[model samples]
Target: MATTHADDPGRCPEPLSTPDDFMGGFCAFNFTSGPAAGSFCWDRQPDYSAYRESSFGHGILEVKNETYALWKWHRNQDLYQGAVGDEIYIVREPERCLLKSSIAAYF
Candidate 1:
């Protein structure tokens, strides 16, 4: 899922939330029977004054066994050329990363 908001500070008082915010809603997709599905999320807020607004971008995710999937984004300004933004790849594996638990819960 994707959402684009204007860069006007008055319009959006809070910082943008990450994709994790939608995780609960995504569980339904995971349970559906079908070819394994992947999820993609994006946010775009362009400064009206600067012509150098966020442009198109693409992503490629490799789910293993050499299989790959790709996604792309194009800014309205580059409608003719179809310019793309930075590319990304997602590699899945059993790994551990530093995680923090809520401190408020312990109080």
Candidate 2:
């Protein structure tokens, strides 16, 4: 899950209580049953990694030399949405990818 820093503080999840801005609630859920002829919990956590915002410093995720997939969806013609938006082949050298302890040295 990817998260960003919040502008201001928020009422943290108090004990077992719900968070002031519960990100989980935004995700839709269902109740599937064999007797009913449907499925439940179709869209659950970790399935669609959520990018939530929290009251903390922000930092971007650094993905290097990785195989990633980008996808899109349509209400009607959803079949083709799974097609790759762009095929990316990343090649990052370890030496160039690493950051120096003395950042000013580069300058």
lDDT of every predicted structure (CA atoms): 0.37, 0.34
How do the residues 23-74 of candidate 2 rate in per-residue lDDT, one tens digit apiece?
A: 5534222345432224322222343445433322223333542543333322
Model 2: ten consecutive residues of lowest lDDT:
4-13
For model 1, name the residue pairs that clash: 56-73, 56-85, 57-85
Q: In every candidate, how many clashes are there?
A: 3, 2
The runs of at least 3 residues in candidate 1 whose Cα sits more than 4 Å from the true structure, single-residue gaps closed, are 1-71, 95-107
Assess candidate 1 and give its TM-score to the true structure.
Answer: 0.24
Which candidate tops TM-score? 1
